[model samples]
Target: MAEKKTPPPNNNRQFAVWGLIILLMLIVFTVAQSGASRPAPGETFTFSDFRERVEASEVQSAKIDIPGGVVTGKLRNGEDYSVNVPPVSADPAGEILDGSGVPYEYAEKTEPSVLANILLSLLPLLIIIGLFFLVFRNMQGGGRGGAMSFGKSKAKLLTENTKRVTFEDVAGVESAKEDLKEVVEFLKDPSKFTRLGARIPTGALLVGPPGTGKTLLARAVAGEAGVPFFTISGSDFVEMFVGVGASRVREMFAEARKHAPCIIFIDEIDAVGRHRGVGTSGGHEEREQTLNQLLVEMDGFEGQEGVIIVAATNRPDVLDKALLRPGRFDRQIEVPYPDIQGREKILEVHMRGKPMAADIDVKYIARGTPGFSGADLANLVNEAALLSARRNKLKITMREFEDARDKVMMGAERRTLAMSDEEKAMTAYHEAGHAIVGLNMEGSLPIHKATIIPRGRALGMVQYLPERDQISQSRQEMIARMAMAMGGRAAEELHFGYDKVTSGASSDIEQVTRIATAMVTEWGLSDEIGPIAYKDTDQQSFHPGIGRGSAISPETAKLIESEIKRFVTEAHDKAREILTDKKDDWIALAEALLEYETLSGDEIKALLDDGTKPKRPDLSGGKRPTVSPVPTTKSSKGPKTIGGPSEA
Candidate 1:
């Protein structure tokens, strides 16, 4: 179908407002200029001087304005003159003029036209009315509300020719797509389902984390079904006025019914669908009212056979129970972050129109990003293209992708950050400790890179790359991770005296504490706290006072805290032991980072294996060395200590 483009609303009303103001200003300016055009009396005289001049036969043809209490005339010498008449004796001025034998008559009193009087009286009221009309017209143009149409639905209609999206445009959530495909199929041909006694679902709720393509999926369903789509936000239905939201809900459903087999998509329904009476101040009456109307419209008394409602929200746990019942939202589809294969598909979709190098491996990029959503992958591709453009490259390559991923994950590198020799050395040693521990510790993830370049909040970083996405971590792996996290602090205390250690290990200490606490309390790793999950007191409760207190008794709480401290202490000691044994290798890696500022996994591995530094590869030519798959091993060094500890 040919797309019809509607012209935008003209701002003629705004121009009219300006024109009215200009006209009023022009009228005032013309009246002031006309008043200034009248001749000024050349000379002023007191009442006595006027009377003397008149009696001396000096006044000639004097004219008196009785209402204004002033007289003007030409003197005998032809000079213009004027005199004031006393308010108490207006008749005296006329008598004096008569006695002077001057040919003078009272100035004729002029009355204004009746039409002018009416127009002057009505001008302000007309300006006020025009202003109100213009303001209301502007409000109506927003399409959300107006002075009189406050209860109208703000849903935007999307036709086939407008913002069309099909299933082919979406990737990475095949299950969600499959579920919605049934809805589309029913809309396409209702007879297929009606004959089999299977009634189509009234609504489906897309539940997921943010940026998982929930809204896009809804649009795709409408496109595939070739039906009209009405898109609105849950917040649009709410207003400060009572009963306004209910009215809007009724109007929206009524409109949807007119176009049968249409889809109505509400984004972020949690904004209005929150559990009633759970707020700090009882509950939001406006939002609760909106949700009530929506619930009724979904499975109301009136038969809405063909209209389908699809809403997206990340916060399904907080939604009202009535909204998720069987009849209202028949399907609750989960749109989670893409797995490895799904991520590759998402990457491919985002990379369609971009110029990519021959060596750009989509699978490799996907593998590196474990918990990335579809939107994240799209951003990654765009960032890579931007990086390539910055370098004046024709196509995005693996190097640009790698740089973009690092920039996204860690943050852009801070090349201009200056550090003193002492600080730089400490940062080098700190990151070196992390790399060495992560590489040699049993069950730890493989170290991808170690760099002393400042990025984000970290002065240096040693990043680990998982071979695959991990669903669960064993106790041994958790212990290894804790030990690795403590390595930086251990190295700092072992090299510099305990008093000289910097706060650079704060993040490492935090990570170690979190891992140890989770292991003991949540994961039930400690035998003393066996197989029990203790609820965290910090968790928020819907009720005012309930669930706010600690679930565990004081004795159990102290025991848990002691166990957490024990786990961290053991991990720290183990890291110190390993660093003491591998002092030479650790020193060599730290010195290498200081010289080169960055080292890849292979370079770090080779440098640790021997004392020799490997030659850096040139990445500017857009060709990168092939990456070998990491061996799936617990540890490669056979648990051997590298060197003897130096004498204190």
Candidate 2:
């Protein structure tokens, strides 16, 4: 093992060293002054003799003369001095006073000379202390914080008791939680495994998108371990200096060693462990050095004993392989978007302290939020509670939950904007078309709610909540979904004629196009194209390069386009047939939507059952049935449901 380099002294140590140096200087001055000031052995001389001695030297001319004494002029070699001569009678040696006696007892002190001597004596120490402070401050990274404390690592210490969150606190992610169970056991009772000569893994890497509970899992491990946890960001190890990042890495490991059987979590490790030489730059020395040191600490000659290093990163593909070898990051756990059950559990966890109305259902909310993470669910609950509070409601209602989900998914509502009656009817029909198609189509995803209320940049939206998380899709299911996506525009064309077709289906069109293109070019589902996937030059952005089997001719492209259009046309015709047969049902749903503006799946299914033959409360007048307008484009007004079926 290489000897770790000692970091430079911190401020407290620097101040202590300076204090000791000053104390030593004062002691030396005291000692020298005490010894040198001892009285000379009975030596006395009259001022007259002093003047003669001064006159004989080269420095005598600079001396000043005073009253009752003979003194020379200003001296050349030394600074000017005024020396007062004692009376000649006071001199026991009786040396006759010279005619020009020098007054050597009194002289003005030179200010410049005193200052120069003091500076000369202290200059080197000041320079050294200043330079030391400069390096330390630079290493520390200044920003009005304690920038001079370079040797102190910037890691947050979390002990089991200090962290209020245990594994039980992190709801959802059952599989991930199960995967971490062994880790918890390893941390809690290392001797159980090590007694059989089993070595514990040095690290585990959590890979997932943000807000997927990566950090929460790490905390759970620490809480389960019941040991010290050191938490820090990957950027905390970096510094502008060449070796500061490496220095921080060394210090962090040293700290972890102090508390053995500990867990150290570094969030977003890709900041320091990016793949080397993949980009234009050869490699960044700071990050490289930090990662290198981290590698060494993980499995160097002196391997990390009883220390587990866990890290989380969203982009694990860009990390260096050396840092992810077997001894290090031994297990890679993925925390993906929550499934339906997981989402329900997560919602329950987040809804703990809130007062919910009886109508509020966790399962419904879970179904509505198809792609929400645990954190997102928590945020949704909190946002709903906030909305309830804002409305001065005593408890959270289902309306608030719905509004919160919409706000989170599609941004805030734009209620103040005004729309023409025609536009409102068009948007209503557009969204109604989507809801009807999604409900009627086989293998279509379940509809959560449909609304014509403008939100975000959309004039209207139809939200379909998946029953569960699906990792794989069948070709039939994909086609059915694409057709459903295109159903809004197709419905507009069939019912309202071409005049009412709006660009409200832009997103839907894009989705359908990509699905159709992929089916023909990548999925090899086209019969004319055979089993070979056609190489799409446009694949650089959307499709992978290797999926293409051959270059497609123009004829094949034309055939693919026709096949796609035929598929869409058949789906559209099927929807029209279903609607035409159930015109009364469609009108009932449209009227209910116009009244409430939204409805859950249960409400819609109930409507579908009784909608076809709604009984009238009044039948006293014997009359032929009145045929209502089909709510098509030619009908400038909204559809009316008089609770009766009309002939098609």
Candidate 3:
């Protein structure tokens, strides 16, 4: 069992601050007391009273304390008396004292603040007692509220809200739930498992993308198991001070073991579990120590049996391998994006209390959003509800859902964006080119919609989706998609001259280049490259874009670029050919898009099917055989005034 940590040693800086505060207080108190001890100016006796005493010869020899500005004397009875008087008196008091045969002497008052030293000596004892009380109170709570107890674990032992989550509250992560359900049974009846010579698995790791509810799944296990749950972030285990984080890891594990059969969840565990020897030169030493202690606590000798460690991280690749071994986190469960049915279930769960219209079909919404995670589906439902409320509607309708889906996927429509006629016409033609090519291409995904309305950073967009959920793409299908990416640029070069083409196709060119490059370098799809592929990244590079040298030589690198450029040029020519053959169909779609800013898949397919013929692409030349493309030609589809040689 781990022992509780004492209060951390106070640093010299803390002592300095305390000393300054005490000195300030002493100065203020001493000044206040000294001011209080001085005699007030109004306490002086009248000069007439002084003369009466003098005439009766009751006054003895008098001496003046100049700094105190008071007269000290003894009367006939040898008693002392003092009176407040001006240090420089007028002639009346002086002459009266001189004529009465009283001898007066002037002397300076020597001492100041004598009593302050005595009070100061006694004050430290009281302050010291108060300091001890404050330190004791803080250490009791693990110094969490102050900088002093940084070594104490920052994990929150949640007891108030564990019952709020169970398996029913979690949606769309069925496989991960299945992986964790056995742990609950083991926690409830460990003897049953041990009888069969099987020890309860020590730990389980939840690995997934962000927003996939890894932490929520852990909470559900706690809720179902009826055991204590401790939650802490990975970053909470790290502090600037050395050894503090390691102390915290030991303390956290010890605490969890006390409540047998409990769960300790570390969220985003990658922060302190990065690959060793890769971070800051010496600054990351603290994190490495924390990770080391965590490793020992999870798998070391006398490792607690009933305390199960559960950790969650989106970045499992960066986590220390030692932490992922058998005894530490035996079960590595993956939580991925929801499937179509799973998405529907997630939507149903999120839409429980929403005031939806009677005719709303949740299956349709789920089918439309193919790759949405559970969290994204929830946000979509919320966005739809808010949109309905904004329109002052009593319930959410299908129109609002569609609008919200569009807003979530492709940004909200920028209705107020200003554009000239020329720019709008250019954008319309650009989007129409994509719709035409996508509709005519073989094995192309169905066109979902086309819009010339400005949205996000785009002037126009044509969106498409696979007929069914797809796991992977074939080489031929990727080439077709690359052709689609080039359609916008090809349209510009066809309608406008090569020299007159605008930079509107910048994004399209980038898309085309990226797809073509991947085909050669990563997907191993190029016939000439012959099943060879370069790594997408280097493991040892410190920065994202910087590299020491290529996996291939400089010459081979040039060859890769040439191949990518050739493939992109061929795709552009293919797009031009398809658009040229279906010029009227493309023109009709563009006119429709200009008139109505948004068009659905069915609407787009209807316009293309009015009188269009199917055309097939020539896939005979694998990698194009390094052939030079043909020269330009005059197409009736192209504008006559903007004629120029076609770009190869």
Candidate 4:
């Protein structure tokens, strides 16, 4: 276990220094002012002495005199030690000064009003000093409550023992893992490489989609190297004030240097490293200046070995090219979604502590979740555990796992929602269209489940499981997939006509649109845009510019649009025809949905084969028999409403 940290105690010596300085200054000022205000040693008597003598002459008073403007008085022999000055003649009992240091002329004290004078003299200086201390405290990280820590980087620090995330902890992206392993070794044993005149690369960049384990890989690198790790988000380097961002970058790098052989991981570095000269969107001077400083530090000539910079970004396209240069980034590791085996391994790692039933098939779950990333898998297990807890079960069963997977992929279950009879019928037809079309496709995933149940925001959903994980998708496979996505809307148009088409198929429409767009603009599947990608490289410029190797004018744009339209139209036609031919199967599937409000993959397959799902002979207990088709897209209809571009 990692040790807990405690704050350092206050310094008594520093406190003493300031306290003594304040005391000495006060004493010096008092002594100097006292000397300046006092009377000299000796001088002749003046008019002041005559006034005192005259005042003393009137009888009971003692002798009095003044010299150098200072008054003196003595008591008469008849008196003890007191002396008195006579009052004015007409008012003999009027106020007067006695020789015991009382005022003679007025009620208030005259010359030697020492204490008040000293305080009066110190008042201005004290006010100035008070204001100075206030300003001092403000500048010295005091008086703003916790505001002073605002500029500090909020990056978390992790070491080998605290992190415990080695390469073994991260699954999938085996190639990327292998590359990062070398980076860890380089950090640990730099001297060995240096003896052979080889310097370790200063930085590595991980570029991939979100939830692909980029940050996790960084932690693993730290653990494998067994060194101090400083982790910060790219946004942490930016601030409202100009130059503050750059200053922070400098500070971060400087702090990392103290550890020498350590990793500094900046997640989402594109926050600061956007292409410069793109105007406002490149971000303000703060971000730009920070990027400049980061560039300098990463590839600076005063190169330090064993100090590595690791950064992760999902959008590498927007990043500045200068930052990605050889000397700066040095290596670019792509962390993509896992393959079949990789997903199984990832699921296994996350399932370590979960109480899963023996019947839970990792492969089945992995196949159903085609595009899931490592993070998504982790979330799946967590969601399943919660579902199990909610049901008050001893352990998580396969059903709970299925619900958890759907909940994570889709939104939460919308149980309170009630669908109208018309809406339910339309959803059933829509999902059944997809299932039937998918079944007819030559090489598509097998249907896992088809249901019109309102889980998530969708009125209906279909899940298809690939017979096995596919590492690469063929062009035919992509087209077949797009056709299945269009089936929902196609069925609505077929049954209710175009006028009755509902927004229920909006998601399906969006998926098809993207696929169609990618085909023409990205993949060059259209002959009109043949073998060329028209994707705007310079997103900095708003207007679309000319493309290379082609003279595509207004007519070409129309042609491209026509190709996309034709592609969707053909897919829709194919779905309508398939569903029409499989009308009996479609009705049977819909009836099953109406009865149960849901259907598992096997149950649906059983419905297609016979009129009902058969019981599982192997499994015991009174549970309803859930069918399982020997997974094949050709022989079986895939799940109902699931269609998307596969992550693999």
Candidate 5:
């Protein structure tokens, strides 16, 4: 049996303290209000009536409160009455009362004590100061320490007893895991390397794109070594006050020294680790001071023998050079996007508890998702399970996974978007042109699917799904891709007359232009441009009065521009020639898209191979089922610009 723990009594004590403060304020207000002038316990009488009665000698006794301006007396009939009077020392009523020979006394005005007067004056100031103290105390996270702990490190310590995540929880980045395994060994037994006079790595930097499991790998190290883990973000060290960040760095390292064998994990170190003097504010900035302190703490005169620092950042290029040297960050581990087999393994890990259909193939899903990170795969599995639950299915099927992949890559289907007949026909022909050109081009990727249904910002799209992950592209492949991009505009101009062509091909023109420019400037595909790399100058480097501009001269710039234009013109001609030769096939495919709205790779191949029309499956009551688009390799979907000036 487990022992049940109760909340601490300090919470009740704090509440009681707050209640007492409120009660004291209320008592002060009540006492001040009680001292104010109040009506006497008697019928209010006019001053003239009281004077006439006093002159008749009907009043027996009376008392006058001078400050309160009220006169109270008892009549001969024993009735009590109060009369309003002026609060002046010399009045005719006083003389009349004295002449009537009625026994009366003047009530003396009472004065507050000296201490009470001082307290009443300072009450508002005290309350305001108390409120400020309470706000600062709450902002300091309620009694962790004092209100002015701005220089204290915000690092949270996680002991081994917390929820443990081993290497099994991490997948898809095997190389990064392997590189960190030695750090675990060092934490377990430092003698293995120390015997040979080899010091353990002071720090390891995990560099990768976002969502590549960098932070997860760090947690796995702590779990494997069964050591304490101190985690904080790079931004947590910085503060608005100068020297605060440096103080925090010193405090964090001092605390880390207490638990010598522990690991300090800094997530997103780029926030504080950027190059120092590059900013316009110069090196005296608070962030630079923090980074300087961090550099010294990692490799300064005093040794941090058993404490290992693990940092993760997506932007390694922005980090300071001194931080990446031999003693500071000894190992720079690259956690790149997973390949096909690694993605499959990642999928299997994510699908551990999911109720998957028996016949579902994980490899197929992995193949279709070429560039998906581990986090992406996890999201895909979650999305698939949600879709299955939505359809009231017991197990997650292949169809559900495919639909989730589509939704993850391309945006959800815009089923309610109503398009005019003319717009719909134009979209169909435009997408059909892309598919036709890609199918005919020798080195182009296989056409996966084509659809006129709007998904994301695209009014229509043709997806090019690569069979394998492409590490690099050849010259032919690049040319073929440009031709495919030009295909959409080429079809629009041919079907509608040149004058009637819409601005729907604006995205296509942009894609073609980008590819042509890259081919000329960076890829060295142009014969005149030669193999020399003419890339853009680094704009981030600071040089006073020197504007960051083009690296090449005007003459060379004009030559590059002409080469880009030549490549685009050739691609455009190639697309037009292909469309003219395969004119009947292109028209048939467009008509099929008009009827079905979408076509898969197999269905399209069958349609173009022979003259057979592709039939959409009638899944629900003789109505055709809507087929959504799939993921693509390059440019997922081309935008269909409408109501804009056409690009030349």
Candidate 6:
């Protein structure tokens, strides 16, 4: 592996190195002074004693370094001594030797050289420069959360000149593209709109679910306009220090103004634009201040003519009212989940550089994927290619794509999960319950698959395939949907005795409960609720779980709970009735599951078809008709009597 690159050494370290050099020079000067002032090996003497000795003619030869105020001499007995005396006189050493009248040679004091003079003169300036360099480096190396550099906007710009993504690269969200086409035209030629009475739109908001290509749409805008792009997240505007977020907001807009006709994309704008006056502290905090600054920059003093703002968020419900008014973000373009034809186009775009088998059909794949987003489809295509490569195939085949889709929707296959024989039998019946009820239910969704292999958190899964995109649902369809969700547990209770039914339908139970509760409380489908939505949310701001702190009486709350339970129980009864009449098909499907371990929609259809074929009875005369009747609303009174404790 390559080594991680590290930052180079800083000025502080160089400062320490220079400081050490200066310290060493001072230490050397002290050592030289000490050595020069040392007395010779014989003995030490006071200044008066040394002068007396010198005057007594005991000193034979004396040498002095006047610059350092030191004298060294040898006596007549050949013992050497040295002295460091004060400069009491103009020539203390020479005068001392002359007063003694001893034989002594004088050495003139030497002057400092030109190089040493220059170094000494510049030493203070060099130390000052090192200090300044260290301080400057510290300021320049300031990191995140540091108090010093708050005004710097954290927006990252696309530096390269090349266009990485054009309109062709973005495969979905055609409506959003159409809305932005005007913005691109405005950027290309402002006169086209300015010539008329049209005032250019200050901003456009792209609202959608997480993986619906909101960010990708922004890039396509830049690539189409051929303008510089400045991209930042709303969270980047916040900082720990007070007033920092507002400062960053001002700085980001100022930067955009530098590059005229530029696109500034702020992703996840809800982070900074949440509804004000929330919680006990209210809007006095820094987030409100940051939002206030952003509002001003977008349209207040700076009218934001040359720079167009494109903000995106999955939670538009929480944004402040002022931030999303008509003057600012005048157009709210929703990038919704793709339709069938759109999904096909998205899949074809993703399949561009990959080898695929001729039999693989994009339209068929799109039909099976009912609720997949753009990102989901892209990942599906990539996963299919990887599965094909794993099998060492030259091109991805239909079988690999099927497995990939199954893995994406359900978790990865767990063939080695090792289920006991009894457990496997119970799972087969539970899944077969879903298949039988889903197929028999009137006006219910289609069943794409049923499998008993362990995937993700569930031991088995019954995958339903919706025929077309459903923008809304009718009351009957909602009830049928709930019944299909509860079919698994109902089948288990019928096949195995009520006392022996397993908790394998916990997930299914949860799904039905949510749908039923929404039907009564949110969707107002219940007759008792009278089409009034008693929802727990603030409608104006669209913020969930913040509904003006309204209170519901205990009696009304009880009634809501009862209605939810009644809806689910009714659906469970319908599912049980349908499964009981088709006992033969139910058993046949379980047996099929045990034998095959999995069954696709077509395979399940064939199994049910073969099971329904007419067969001969024993040679003895048949007693009563052996044929089973298809269930209807006539006999939906079986499982409603016994209350099975099915906990989700």
In terms of TM-score, the best-performing candidate is 5
Please give the clash total of every predicted structure, in order: 0, 11, 0, 8, 0, 0
**Candidate number with the higher lDDT (2 or 4):** 4
- Which window of ten consecutive residues has the lowest lDDT sum in model 5? 639-648
Candidate 6, residues 173-219, lDDT tens digits: the string is 88889999999899999999898879878989999999999988888
Candidate 6, superposed: residue stretches over 4 Å from native: 1-149, 277-284, 538-553, 611-648
Give TM-scores for every candidate, taking all chains together and pairing residue i with residue i: 0.81, 0.71, 0.79, 0.73, 0.85, 0.74
Give the runs in model 2 whose Cα sits over 4 Å from its true position: 1-113, 116-140, 143-152, 279-283, 522-524, 530-588, 600-648
Write one digit per residue (lDDT tens) for candidate 1, span 1-648.
Answer: 113344554556556778887876665565445344244477989899988888898888788876567788899898998887754544787898777678888877655567556656677887798778867756554453344566888788787886678999899999999999999999999999999999888899999999999999998998999888888898888776667788899999999989888999999999889998764322377788788898898988877889999999999989989999988887999999998999999999999988999999988898888888888899999999999999999999999999998888777888887555566667677778877777778888877778887777677887777888888889988888878878888877777667656677666676677777777767778988898766464662112223225655567777877888899999999899899999999888877777778889889988888766867643224332221221222111110111101000
Q: Residue 470 lDDT in model 1?
A: 83
Ranking by lDDT: 5, 1, 6, 3, 4, 2
Name the candidate, 2 or 6, with the larger TM-score value: 6
Please write out the lDDT profile of model 3 over residues 511-583, one tens digit for every residue.
6677777788777777766567664465421121332366567666766777777889988888999999999
Tens-digit lDDT string for candidate 4 (548-568):
325456666666677778778
Give the candidate number with the greatest lDDT.
5
- Candidate 2 lDDT, 1-648, residue by residue in tens: 111233543466556656866865665565455334222222233455454555575334322223233333345455443334543434321232233443333223223356456655776787677667657765566522345445457777776554356777777788888888888898788889989998877898999889989999898888776778888899887776667778778888898999988888999999999976654323377678778888988899998777889899999988999888899888898888888888888888888887889999888788777778888898999999999999999999998988898898876767675655555556666666777766776777777666666777776677776766666767777767766666667656665677656566666666666676677666777676666656555554224333334554556667777766666666667666666666666667656555555566677777787643233332213332222233333322222110000000
Q: Which residue pairs come into collision in candidate 5? A: none
Root-mean-square deviation per candidate: 8.4, 12.2, 9.9, 10.6, 6.3, 10.2
Look at candidate 1 and tell me the lDDT of residue 464. Answer: 77
**Which scores higher on lDDT, 5 or 6?**
5
Cα displacement (Å) at residue 518, model 4: 2.8
Model 5 Cα lDDT, one tens digit per residue, 1-648: 111132442465456558857866875986677587787877777898988899888898898888788888899889898989888776656777888898888888788777678777777777787777778777655533455565788787876675788999888888889999999999999999999998888999999999989988998999899888889999888766678789989999999999889999999999999988865443348889999999999999999979999999999988999999999997999999999889999999999988999878998888888888999999999999999999999999999988898778777889787665566677788888888888899898877678788877778888767777888889998889888888888997788767656666777787777777777767788999897556555653222233235556667777777887899999999999999999998988987887788788889999989866666553223432232221122233333522111111
Model 5, position 583, has a per-residue lDDT of: 93
Candidate 1 local lDDT, residue 418: 57
Cα lDDT computed for each candidate against the true fold: 0.78, 0.67, 0.73, 0.69, 0.80, 0.75
